[model samples]
Target: MDSIQQFLPIIAMFAVVYLFMIAPQMKKAKNEKKFAAELKRGDKVILKSGLHGKVAELYDKDNSCIIETMSGKLKYDRSAISMELSKSLNKPEAKS
Candidate 1:
């Protein structure tokens, strides 16, 4: 009973950490992976570094892709794509 009481706080701390930090991170990674897998040629996306371009080619085996930008086409890892920015860019503008 005494040992369980001593470990209670540690267990609670771990639960809090998992709920507040680890869980959201895992969810985000899963969503990002889904986003990456769904990416197809001609879909517009923004990189983590903020470079915007349309996907030119996807190398699924290597998890990399080539994007066509105004300057030229460039290659980047699939993980470099930003979900939030890409979604926002693809959203239809609202009229007031």
Candidate 2:
């Protein structure tokens, strides 16, 4: 009983950390993966490096894509795209 009591705080701390930090990170990663898999040609996106462009080509075999920017088309891994930023960029603004 005494040993369990001593370890209770540590266990609770770990639980709190998982709930507040680890869980959200895992969820975000899952959402990002789903976003990458759902990507298709002609969709606008923002890269992790801050470049904005439209998806010109999808290479499923390599998990990569070609983006068409104003300058030219560039190839990059799908994971290089930022799901949050891309979604925000594509979101329509309010009329008000």
Best by lDDT: 2
lDDT of 2 by residue, 1-96 (tens): 999999999999999999999999999999999999999889999999999999999999999999999999999999999999999988999897
**Model 1, range 1-96, lDDT digits (tens) per residue?**
999999999999999999999999999999999999999998999999999999999997899999999999999999999999999998899999
Q: Estimate each model's TM-score.
A: 0.90, 0.94
What candidate 1 gets wrong by more than 4 Å, as runs, is none
What's the residue-level lDDT of 33 in candidate 2?
Answer: 97
Error of 2 at 65 (Å): 0.2
lDDT of 1 at 46: 94
Clashing pairs in model 1, backbone N/Cα/C closer than 3 A:
none
Residue-level error in angstroms, candidate 1, position 56: 1.3
User: What's the lDDT for all of these models?
Assistant: 0.96, 0.97
TM-score, model 1 to reference: 0.90
Residue 74 shift from truth in candidate 2, angstroms:
0.5
